[model samples]
Target: MNAWSNDGLWLAGIAAVAGLTASAASLGWLFSRNRYRAAVPDSSYPPEVLESLYHHSPIAFALIDRQGRFLDINRDPADMIGYGKHEVSGKPFLSLIAEDMQEAVRGLFLRALQGEQISQEIKVKHKQGHAIDLFIQTSPLIRRGRTIGILAFIQDFSERRRSLERIRYMAYYDDMTGLPNRQYFKKRLEEKLASARMRGSMLAVCYIDVDQFKLVNASFGRDFGDMLLLQIAERLSRSLSEPGDLARMEGDEFAACLDNLSSAEEAQERLQEILSVLKEPFELRGVPVHITVSIGVACSGGEDDAATLLKRADTALHRMKENGKNGYLQHSEDMDHVAMEKLTIQHEMRRALENKEFVLYYQPQYDLASGQIVGMEALIRWMHPERGMIFPGDFIPAAEESGLIAPLGEWVIEEACRQNKAWQDEGLLRIPVSVNLSFRQFTEKNLTSKISGILEKTGLHPRYLELEITESMTMDVERASQDLRELTEMGLHISIDDFGTGYSSFHYLKTLPIGRLKIDRSFVRDIKQDPSDAAIVAAIISMAHKLQMQVVAEGVETKDQVHFLRSHRCDEMQGYFGSPPLSSNSAHALLMEKVNRPALPAYH
Candidate 1:
C-alpha cells in the first residue's frame, strides 16, 4: 500500500476489521427518508425508527450527500464535533476533522460516494476541542442501483494510541537520564554520518565516561547517583550547539555525534566547553559534590564507519583513563598500543598483589619550629618483577581503571600499619604513619570496619594511624563529615590532602573533624618564583591555625620555602628540603635518631 493509504490498522484498537462496503441495513437507513430518497423507501422501518436507533447508538454516526455535505449528524456524532444536530445538518463533513486533514477527508469521502467504501483511522477535533484519534468506517448507500449518500461510523482510539506511543518511547529513550538509548543513538549517529559524507563536512564522535562514577554512587548512595546522572544528561543535552545527539550508553558512560564541523579543532573546543561546565559543582540532596568527565574524541576520516569511529573514540577514552583521568584526548593510531599496555598493567598489578611485590616508601614530615621529624607519609611503590621498579604514578591509574583500587588501597593501609608496628617493635620512633586513601576506598561500605581489622591484624595503635584523603573526597559535605567523625572516633587522624584544588567549602573544612590540611605541592613548587603562591601558603597556614587544625606544607624543596613556612609558623613540613621518600630501612634509621636537631639553617 502507498504511504498515505490508511487501509490497515493504525494503532491496533477495537474496530473488528469491519468492511465498509454498503450493507443492507445502511441502504435501508439511507432510503428511510421520503424526500431525499433516490428510490423506494423500505417499509420495514419508518424514518422515525431509523432516527431513534441512530441517535441512541453509542457509535458516532453521520450521513453525507454525494457532495460530501453533512446531510445529517446523529446526536452522538454531533456531540463528538462540539455541535448540535440542528447546528451542523448542512455543514461539510471536513469541518469535523483536524484542519490539516480536511483535504484528505474530502478526498476519502468523495471516493466513498463514487462507490469506493473506505475504512481508515483519522484524527478529529473533539467536542471539548482537543484532537482525538478515531477509527472511521464509511459505507456507500444505494437505492435502485443509484448512490445518493453514505453512512459513517467513528470509534475512539485515543487510549490505545497513547499506550502504543508510550511503549515506543521507552524502547528508544534512557529511563534514568531521558537521553537516547544506545540503539537509538546508533541510528541517529548513522544519519549524521551520512549527512557529513554528503556535504564533505567533518564529524566528531565523543565518548564520555565519568571518572570513578561508581564510587560516587557507592559512597553517597544509589539515589544521589541517579540524580547526578539526570542532571548530567540535562546539562549535556543543552550543551550541544551543533546538530548532534547525546546518548546514555551504560552506567556512567555517554556518547555524542557532532557533525558539520569546519575542522577538528572546532570539535575540540566544543568538547572542552562541556568539560568546563561539568567542572562546576553539582549539589544533590543538599550536599555539593564535584565530578569530572574523561572524554575521547574522533574526527571523521575520509571513510569511516560507525563501528570504526566509535571504537577509535573508545580507545581514546581508555587512554584518558590510563593517563590519569579527568582529562580529554583526541584519538590517534598510537593510542591503541597504549590501550594494550594498560591491559597488561592491569593484569600485572593484580598478579603483583598475589606475589607480594608492592612496597611502601615513607617520606618524613618535620615540625618547623623544633627541626625534629614528626611522622612519615606512606607512598606505594610497585617493584614489578620484569619492569624492575614502578612508581604509583605509573601503575596506580591502571589499577583504578581495572577496579583494583579497593584491594590495592586496603593493602597499602595494612602494610603501612604493620610496618609502623614493626618499627616501634625495633625500638624506633612511634610517629603516626599516614596512608593516602583513593576515592574508591571511601566508597567501601565497611571501610571503618576494614580499617579496624587492619589495625588489629598489624597490632598497631590506632593513635599512630593516619588516613589522607583529597579535598574532592569531602565535596559531599554531609557524607564526608559523618565519615570523618567516625574515623576520628576510631582514633585515626584524617588529613585533607591537595587542599586548595577542590570544590569543598570553608564551612566543611572548619566544621568537619579533619585533623590537618596538606598544602598542595603545586602551590609550594613555585613559592619563591610566584608571590601568589607564598600568599596562598601564608593564608592557608593562618586559616588552619585559626581553626585549631595543623597544616602540612608538601614538596618544600628549597631553603627559602623552608624559611617562608617557618616565618608563617606552619605546623609541619615535608619535601626534599627535609628528605625524599625513603625505603623502610632508611626511614627507620631517621626514625631511630629521634633527637631534636637544633640550630638548623631555617628553624634556628
Candidate 2:
C-alpha cells in the first residue's frame, strides 16, 4: 500500500503524530497525506522519512486538534515561538500568539477547523516576551466531510516589515534635521494648494535662506555647522503654527507652507513670528552663534500652482538677499516681471557667448594735453538677434549673478589682446587696450596665468594689454596686492576702475603695483555743477599723482568738464565727448585714421 485510507479517525491520528509539512490537497490529505484510499499502516513512506521532513522543513508546520489544542509541531514552528516541540504539544494553540491578538487568532483557528483554507498575517509571542510578526496559511484536516484537525504553514515576516518602515522614513524625512525633506514638502504643498483653490482660502509658501551660512561653516567646522542646522530646524518647526508645515529643502535653505490663513496679512504675521524666534542665539559646544535668515513669501491667489508659487517666493527671496539679507519680502506681480526679464537675459547671455553675438566696442581714451588717442577701453555689447544692441548695464548684472562672468571676462581679455595685436600687425599705432575685469574674475586663482596664456596666444605684448579692476576688488588688499603684483611682474598694466567710489584704503594703495586710477564717472558727471564733486575729483587726481600713479577721468562730456580735468593735470580721459564705444570695425577705421594723420600729436 502507498497511502492511508481517506477516513476521519485514521487521518487525524497521523496528522497528530507526523506534523505534516505539506499543505492540504484535500480534507483527508491534510491529516494523513491520503490519496490512494489505502490504510495508514500500509503507507509507502517510512517513519524515518516523515521524521526528517518534520524536522528539516524550511516552512514552519503545526497541527492542532478540533479543540484548538496543539496536536504536534515541526522543528521550524517550535523554533519560531522559542519552544521545544514537546513543550508545545497538547497546549492551546493561542498560547503562542500575542495576548492582544489571541482572540482574533482564535476565530481564524475555528474557521480553519470548519474545512476552510485561510491565509493571514498575525503577531505571535516569543518565549523572551518580544512580539514576532508572522504570516500563516491554515487548512482543515477532514474525513468524510467532517473536520478533524487544522494544519498551518507559518513564516517570519519581521525583517521585511522593518525594511519597509526604513524605506518609508528615508523617502519622507531628512535624516540630519529630522524635518520633512524637499520631496515630502513639495508633495504636501501641492496638496495644500489644491485644497486652497477649492475652498478659496489663503495659504502662503515661504522660501528661506540662511544668511552667511557659508562663513559659519568655514569658521566653525562642519560638525558645529551640523549642530547649528539642527538647532535652526528645531526652532523653525516649533515656531510654525499648527496649520503650517516646515521642511529642509537643501543645505542652508528651508521651505514652509502655511494653511488656513484668513488673509495674506495673517500669513505674514505668522511668518514674522517664526523669524523673530530664530533671531535667538544657538549654542554649540559651549560657543554661541547668532544667525539670520532671508525669507520670500507668496500667498495663494485664484489659480496659483506649486511651481509658480515656489518660483515667486524664491524670487522674492533673491531680491531680499540682493537688497541685503536678514529680512523678508512678499512677492508682487512686479517682481515676477523683473524675474522673467532677468531669466530671459541669463538664458540669452549664454547663447550670446556661444554664438558670437557678443562683440567688443572700443571707446578711445585721449591724452588731455595732446588731443590724441593714447589708448582705448574695450567694452562688451550683446547684439541679441531679437533685441538688437543690449548695453552692459542691461546684461552684466545678470552675468555676474549667473557666474557667466568668468568665461565672459576671459573672452573679453583674449579678444582685446587679439585685436590689439591685429592692429599692430596692420601697421597701425601700437596703443595699449584696457578691458574691465569683474570682481569674481579678479579673484580667480588662475587669473594671472589665464591672462598670460591669452597674451601668448594672441601674440600681444603684456604691456599692451591693460586690466581694469574696480575698487571693490581691492577691499581684500592683501590678496588683491598679491594678484596685482603677479600681473605687473608679467609686464601687464593694472588700473583701478571707479577708484574712489568703493571702500578704499589709502594705506594699502602705496603697496599695490597699480599704474593708474580711473576716477569714478559719478564724481566727474556733476563736477561742472556740484562743487563737492569738483573738489572730490581734484583731490583724487592730486592723491594719484602723490602716489606716483597717473589718473584718468571718466565721463568727460562737456568742454568745461574737459578743461577742469586738464587743469587738474588728469593724464587721460574717455567719454562721449571723445567718442562713444565703437564696434571693432569702426574702431579699426578710427585707429587707421590716427595712424595716417600727418601730425598726430604725441600720445602722453
Candidate 3:
C-alpha cells in the first residue's frame, strides 16, 4: 500500500510543477515582447520601419551606439563627404568629427545619448578635399527604458554658408574696383584703431581725391571710367603694401590707413612717393590720361580716433583743393581751426546771401590815354552785422568752395545792375558797369539764361553791362566760346581779366568773342621798373589791338607807371593812383562829376 500511493503522489506533484513552469515561461515571453514593442513603437524594427525612416529622410542620418561608435550612416551624408556607406559604418564617430568640433560634438552626443535632445551647426572635413558646414540634430535611441544609441539628423549647408559669405563680401567690397568700400573701410579702421590704442602707436589717414576726375569720367565713357578706377585701385593698393589697408571712399576718392608710423615726416615721405607715382600718366582704354591727386594727411595723436583722423584728413584735402589742386597737405591743429573757420564762413555766407547782407562797391576804371572815368568795376563787400565789411578776399573763396558762388554771383549781378541803374537815374555817369564772374558761375549750364534773367529783372540795358572772366577760365575754349558768343549777342561787353599770367592758347583766345583784355596787375605793377614786364605789357597791348580787343592796364599806382602805360598807348587804367575802391555813395558822386580826359605827356 505504501509503494503504490507514494509513486502516484510523486508523479502528480511533478506534473503540477511542470504545468506552473510552462505558464510562467509564457507570461515572461509576453511581457518581454510588449516592452520591446513599446521601446521601438514599431512592429518592424531594424529592417523595414527604422531602415525606411533612415533611408528616405530628406536629411542625412547616422545611427550611433551609446559608446559613440557608428552603427550605420545613410547615403546622403556619405555622399556629402565623398564616401560610400561601407567606408564609414562601424567607425568611431568621433574620428569623423572635425578636430576643432570634436569636444563640442562629443559633449552634445553624450548628452543626447543620456536622453537630452541637441542641435548644432558644426564644421566638418570632407573626403573631397574641402571643409563643409553641417546642421546636425541628435536625439536618444531608447530600448526597454534605457538609451542604447544616438539618432543623428544631419544636413549639408556648405552652399548656404557660401552664399552668406558672398553677400557679406558684396556689402564690404566695391563692385567696380574690388577695393573695400566705405563701410568695410570704417570697420577695418576701427579695428586697427583699437590695436593702435592698445600699442600706444600712431596711425595716419590719407584722403586722396583725384583732381578733375569729373572731366575724366565725362570724357571717357563710364565703362572706361570704371576701368580707370580699377587701374587706380591697383596702383593705390600696390602703394598700401598691406592687406586691408586701402579702401575706396567714394567716386574718384580713395582713403588709406598708414599704421605704425613714427612721425608726420614719415607720413609725408610716404605720401610724397605716392604722389610721384600718381604723376605718371595712366593708359586708359588706349588713351594716355594724365592725372593728379590732392592728398590730405592726418595722423593719430591727442585723442584722435579713426573718425577724427579721417575727418581731419578730409579737411586737409579740402584745403589742398582750395589752395590749388595737385598737392598734399599734412594737417595741424591750426589747419583744423582754419578749416572750422572756413566752415563757419561758408555757413554764414549762405545765410548772408539769403538775408541780403551783401552789397557791391564800385571801383573807377579810367581810360589810360585819357584819365576820364570810362566805366566802373563792381567789387563785392559783405556788410556782416557783427564782422563789419568783410572784403571779397575774405569770403569769395569760401563762397566758391561751398557752391555758394552761383547764388552769390546772381546777387552780385542783380544788385550791381540795379545800383548802376539807380546811379544813372540819380544823374551819375551812364557808363556800362563791369562785374566779375567766377569760374564756377561761368561753367554753370544755365549761366547764359541766368544772366539774361537777371538783366531782364533789373530792367538794365544789356549795353550797360560788362562781364569779366579770368584768362585761365577762357582756356576752356568750347565753353568759353559758347558763353562768350551768347553774351556778345546779348550786347554785353565781355573782357578777359588777369591776362598773360595764364599761359592760354591763342587759338582758343581768338575763338572767344572777348571785347577787351585786362593785363593783370602783376605785370602792370612792375611795368616801368622791369624791362621784361614792359615788353610783356607792350606785347599784350599790341596783340589785343590786332584782335580788335581793347586793352585795360590794371594797378597804375604811380605817375611813372601811368606815363609808361600811356607811352605804350594802353587803353584803360584804374588804381589807387586814380582812387581807391569807393562806397556806393562816393562812386555815384564820382560818376556824377563830368571831367575831360586828364592830360598826359604826349609820347612821340
Query: After superposition, which runs of candidate 1 have C-alpha atoms over 4 Å from their true positions?
Result: 1-297, 300-305, 316-330, 593-602
Task: Sort all candidates by lDDT, best to worst.
Answer: 2, 1, 3
Q: What are the lDDT scores of the predictions, listed in order? A: 0.80, 0.82, 0.78
Pairs of residues clashing in candidate 1: none
TM-score of each: 0.58, 0.87, 0.82
lDDT of 3 by residue, 529-604 (tens): 7999999999998898998989998877898898888877888887888788898988866666644435233344
TM-score for candidate 3, residues paired by index? 0.82
lDDT of 2 at 523: 94
Clashes of each: 0, 1, 0
Residue pairs clashing in model 2 are 5-38
Which whole-number lDDT from 0 to 100 does residue 23 have in model 1? 62
Error of 1 at 401 (Å): 3.5
Q: lDDT for model 3, on a 0 to 1 scale? A: 0.78
- Top-lDDT structure, candidate number: 2
Query: For candidate 1, which ten residues in a row score worst on lDDT?
Result: 4-13
Model 3 stretches astray by more than 4 angstroms: 1-63, 69-92, 115-117, 141-145, 197-201, 215-220, 239-241, 262-269, 272-281, 286-292, 322-327, 595-604
Show the lowest summed lDDT stretch of 10 residues, model 3. 1-10
lDDT tens digits, residue span 1-604, model 1: 1111111111011122223244634443334344223443446434444445544656666667777777654453553556677766777767778998888888898888777768888888876888988888887766567776776777778888998888987988888777888888777888888888899899888999998888888888999898899888878877886433799989889998877799877887888778877977899777888999999998888778787888899999977887899988999989878778889899888889999999999999988888777888999999987879899989888888788999999999999999999988987777899999999999777889999999999999999999999887887788888887888998999998988988857888877898899999999999889999889999999998999999999998988888888888988899998889999988877776654553245465
RMSD of each candidate relative to the true structure: 10.7, 4.5, 11.3
